[model samples]
Target: MPVVRLCEDMKEHPKTSKHKCPVQIISLDDQGGLALANEALSQCLEQGDVGDAPVCLISIIGEQRRGKSFLMTCLLRQLQNQEDKDASWMGSDDEPLEGFEWRSGPETVTKGVWMWGEPLWVQVPQGKVAVFLVDTEGSMDLQRQLETSIKLSVFSILLSSYQIFNILSEFKLVDQDYLEMFITVAEEVGKNFNLYPVQHLDLLIRDWQHTSTYGVEGGQEHLKRVIKDLESLPGNDLVLKVLKAAETQCYLMPHPGTRFTRSNRLGDFEKDFQDCLKDYVTTLVALPAKHVRKDSNGHALTGKQLAMKIRDFFQFLEENHYDFSSPVKMAETLANMREQVNRKIVDIIKGEYSEFVLHQDRDTQTETHCLNISPTEMQKKLEEKCQELLERCRRELLGDEQQKEAMVQDVGQELRQMLEGFMSTYNWRFKEMENAANRTIKDKFKQQYKGYITDQGRENKARLQCCRVQPRKMRQCLEKKGQELLQQCEEELRGAGDRKQAVLRDLEQELTEQMDDFLSNLE
Candidate 1:
């Protein structure tokens, strides 16, 4: 295996290496660098084989030529030591597996966001994690504008789980401005993006010196004071809430200076810097990895989701003129999402309820055969079917409680309408059945009258009695039986109507009850 550097030329990636390609994943440029970075990051993720491990991204940002890359290298080495005591520096066939290069110059080298070739699988107190390192381009560039600086700063902070602000001494005016911008935008982040992991900032002060008279507690205290002072600035209330001093850890380190080689090799770094850095790296390892989305369930979002979120975030910024704290824009986004869920709920209701109607119609036909079918029995059957469909509709609801409840009501109302339609059709079917029963009774009466006439003609010898008395009596008796049959048919139709009305009522009650239960669960 051979190590390849990210943010470098792809042609330079070692062809023979199967295990490593430590090359520049992305070098952000105007035309297509971001797209390339996205692709490279994707490929890197695939190659790293993170397995089932949770991923933690740790990145560095600060002034240009401030050894931010060197600091990242130091942290990686220390973390590696904690990962495996007997791990070798060389890969297969003596291939170099060392980290970022460091030189004693005041010129910027690393550009844009850079990721390590492989993720470090380390054990934290919580659990094991696959850690990726990001080295961002340094700030305060003469070539770039303040706007560019702000964008890069925001991107780095949003992307990383743990960020190292590698300052040579103190926070510059630009740094303060960048931080303030982050604070302001962070409030609106949740409305639009999956702001995961509650990013942690660590101010690593290098080339340390005591400038404060109240530095009785040493560099950590001084760091805290700096942060406190930043937080105390006007309009810093939101920033302080998001990036509190308690959440922000601070570490102090001396300049490697002449004691370290310029070769950027791990073996050549100063022992003192290594020792101090070990604890710093350990602190990072102990911190758990974050998900971009706050999971309501046990599962967390994967690396792919983070990548997609980053893409969408930038797109949103571009379209909205980088207006981070735009309530209107956030609200619009939410409205669009809610609309989508509403449409989904509609589709689910139509499909599920339609299927239910097909089954319910068949069942009603079979059940109608029973002359004594009670309203209670019909209600039980309707409730069973309605309850099933209601549960399916409940599952279709998405987003916040308000949106979910609104969708539940929408489903219930639509379902009730469907039930009413079914009842109307059922009433019409009952009318047809009643008509058919009446026609059968009339036909039976005609047959009986013909038999009575044939009997009277055969007894012609008693013509007077047969024609007058018997015919009159038979006609009267037949008319009375016909009336009774019609009354029975009318009674059955009325009973069927009552049962249909009962089923409809039961369905409406069930829908309302289920809607209440679903909304309560959301809370």
Candidate 2:
């Protein structure tokens, strides 16, 4: 359903010429091509279609201004006509070409990657598989660098299930060297970036002369000899290794001698090439569906996923500055890595900080008495912990120390309020303890005064003659007892104060030493 709606939304307008169609799949800027495949692909995802369907992708690559576009045009036309087996399509002489142009004396007319409006649906053994076509800008463009060309080739190979390597003449040593360069770069890219799959490479030897030696034996032997000699060349064993790993196929075609030179000539050359072209299309369609980049379910990428991946590919190329040769570019990459590490560190510290605060609260809950701590002191502890963590991260992650300091300050401010709330609860508990202690001391003094009065009454009766002396003596005795009671209350208060001070000192020492040890490694 997704693909059906996708096809409907992305269907090409019949009136718009292919060359001028605004919905071109990709376009190039100064840096590289942008994958605009989402224009149609997004609809595919929206409609719940093309789910887990295997897909086969074919891409063409070759030297510039060598009728690559023409070949693509011819190939696409034949492919589209396959659904209508009753009709036969031949190049028109009376009208302008309808698809990709056959431009002559080119200044590299094809700029970036281009794709057919809709993928051709073919029934394979697996199911209905969509065959996607991608046509890239030819290699060795006058305006592009060798690095750019290699990147484009690598990019194309990465995106396709089968890659057509189009060449103007017989395969040469220069071709081997170019492939060796690609192998090296591909290996590196696979290790550092996304790991690209080894796809089937179809070597298309264009403009082959019809000499007797140009037969199957000659072309096959030539390719084998090149591979054999390439093994002896410096650092070419890797190229051979990659070729052996991939499914390499070759096709040799003779030159289309004056096939479309005249306005109305449709000669034997055209007929023969068309027959061969039909066979090529047949072989292409019958080729088993190979999902080079499959999702977890081993299904080919949906339209949306494919579009996004294409975007990421070009972005990857741009970020690397076409190649990782410049020192400035490499430095930028390192900076980006550091920034990523900084973000991860922030996340890790947040978790650690939260867990620590939770444990601190639990520890307070298990204490015998409410801690007599002030809001300012609590705030200082929280800030110190935050700052310690931030400094550690700065030394280890080495990214935006100022920014990290600001973050720590923000976190500290937030936790400052939490600490204040906890301190309020502790203060309330302390107030209750003070009230209880006062009541117990008052009750003890009251009971002791009553006993002293009773004893004094008995003594007064025993010395009745010295009543005046008794009054003064009783007063002195009462005063002494009262003094003793006051001393007892003062001693109890001093013990309470000492207990409070001891608790405070123990807490301060424990936390200070813990924090110091935790931060020592950072220093």
Candidate 3:
């Protein structure tokens, strides 16, 4: 069974002070099969606020028994100091490095991937970021099978944003070959997963022989020489290409004195070694923004998001029964899976768009009265709703830039076409309804004006008869009075048409003429 050593159960060295210990996140079975320690991994990566905050993972990988774990222990101490706000990250002179298990021996201590139980929360310019340290089983161990090493290295590369390639004394051809193979596989995996293959790689060379040259300056000089030498050789193009493409840096360290090596304790570090280590750790942790893990689109990954991705990768491997030996086969499987996911995502977005339109249509039909809205207004609203849906689709999309753009174009075109069709039908219906309304209002106004004119004529005729005037004089009086009534009716009717301005001009002229005729006949 895989063991998850609890923090309290971890053994503390008699001579060194006790501190938090790392838990095995990935364990190897007796048969050398990989198994994810889900409970332990989740506890470390997905708990409380740290899980939701942006995360940075730093992992170290190299040959077996090269102080890889010791280096990680140093990093852990520095981070803890920062978290506690100590006067100096470098603790007391006699403080023993206590985190990852390391001892002076030829045997490998870490068998699989181990992660610090607690995440170090650091505040930077970008805001608080959670940093996780990973220590992988060292590669190129004679006792370990080749497949195990490959799997461990691949997992390390996939999980880490900042990868430290630890070397004993110098960079060598074998190291270059191993790095090339691991990175190539990682790049292939990243292509299908919408992740960055490698963000930052640090080449850490320990126990440098050169006395005058140390630290970053010596590391850069040595790296240039190594690359130049690789260029002169044949069949080294791939490694050279990877090295140049990735964001890489180098750091060289002098041996931590012969006494420290023999004792394998932090207090035994040479004065120069301790100072250099301080400088390295301080610089590394100070620039958290540069190391924050990001996706293919350059968006930072929260701790929860990073954890999900890791789980997804392991799940994929398990489902496919990956043997961890064939990159080509793995890539093929990933390609097939990606195609399926893309199709599903597009289908989902299209369905959502359809549902949204249907809901809007139902809302419009259920209204008790017409909206009195113009086609232009309706079109504007439809476009905005469609744009909102498209934006949501864009956020959920996963793929390379070219693939995402193509999907977006296809989806956008479909939405635009749908909007155009809906608008065309809507405009036609609105025109019909508007014309009907105008005709009804026009008829009502005409009848109302005719009635007023007839009433005025009757009253004038009755008044003339009552006066008992001569017929010619009565006719003159009736004509003059009828003209005055006609002007009054015109002014009253003018205000009613203000609501229906489109037909007002024609209705007004027809009503005026009819009223004038009525007044003339009365005369």
Candidate 4:
């Protein structure tokens, strides 16, 4: 990826250079409907120098006029410095922050999700990753509809790997309520879709009055207190669950100083506020790999993959006509999507199994006779084949390990039942073939023995007539003939046993060949 710096003069650069600025990736139509800036978002995610690289999105969300845009601007500067390995990331303090538009006013400035057009290329142990800075429109504006605020918050959480939940003064009841609702929605969506919805959540308390606790240590203390207090409450289970689910952090920033707030410049900010800000931004960018966006399985996502997921989520909402009016409605939508995914998994397994059976049948048709494998060996091969199918299905399943395992077990049971039926049919056919072969051999031996006995009787009659003159000689001849007939009968019985053994041997060889073919096809 290229190392492109933010323009020094936003006005002149817009006219003279190809350097890009933050662009809105999501917006609201005049009719109050959600509008996705597909082309713009695609440009930022797919067409840039960061193409196909794993991405780490950093987004800031808070109430209106809470310096979210300004903070993103600071983050942009820090990112630039981090990329260049320069200590002068803050640049000239007199230079006004020029990334995302920010000003001290009650009115909202950013209307929707705005993404910096160019990604900061950060090198990590795994090579390089792209980091995108996002500025979301502030939430809880009285002028905006409740649904709008919810939508913005949801989108922010969905798009960012590291989200800064900017708050004024300290964490309050209202913040808790809003956060709970947002986290609930996120959690629901995540559970249904098998996604890691919240990766890192940073509760950034602005203008903290507590002088003793200022940075991370203080922030952590305050968070524990708040959590403990909420734990005593009756209905904060979801909030607690989400907190535990994500990696949480808190930072208390001292007031940026009155002069800096008035001038909207870095030079006038309090030294302590500046120091804290630097620390926060540095820590965020220090280990980009740690914050890389991942799926539920903790596999990092490339830019294009991330873009597709974002688009898919928004498209689902749009198709469902979700108003984002209530968490209940969100839950219902997610449940529906989950069901669809579940059905898709079932269908995939069914299709794969069906194909496998069909292939086996085709191969079976080419065989001249039944492959006589022992029942034990047959059962073992069938079980192995079933397991192979289960593993294939497991890969197609999406969810946490526990959920995936449950689904796999269910599929496995179904496969075993099917194989049981198949085994029954095979065993029945093999038994029928064996019984028929035995009967045919018995009938052939019976006919030959009957003919031999008749011939021996006629020969004995002729010999008796010829030996009538000598009674002793006749008796001796008759005894000898009887002994010869008995020996011949025994030899025939032995030959029949040998023929049965040969048939069994042929069947065993055929079974081995069939099993080898089946296993090779599986591989």
Q: By lDDT, who's the top model here?
A: 3
Residue-level lDDT tens digits of model 1 in 424-444: 676566555544543454445
- Computed on alpha carbons, the lDDT of every model, listed in order, comes to 0.54, 0.54, 0.72, 0.71
Give lDDT: candidate 1, residue 199.
Answer: 56
TM-score between candidate 2 and the true structure: 0.53
lDDT of 2 by residue, 231-295 (tens): 76777676677655536756666665674633222243454455555566566655646644453
For model 2, the local distance difference test gives 0.54
Count of backbone clashes, every candidate in sequence? 11, 1, 0, 0
Q: Which stretches of candidate 4 lie over 4 Å from their true place?
A: 1-19, 48-51, 83-87, 244-246, 368-410, 425-523
User: Can you write out model 4's per-residue Cα lDDT over 1-523, one digit (the tens) per residue?
Assistant: 1111122233321311155578777776554566677766666678755557889999887788888888898888888777555547877778877878888867788887888878888888888988999888745666777677777776787678888899999888888888887787677656754568788899999999876568899898888888888898899997777655549888999899989878877789888888888888778888678998887778888888877766777666655545457777766767676666777887778677666655654543322345445445667877777777787766556555677789888888777777777778766665565556554544454444445445544555577554532434434443454445434434433224665666445443443443344334323
Report model 3's TM-score to 2 decimal places.
0.79
- Evaluated against the true structure, the overall lDDT of model 1 is 0.54
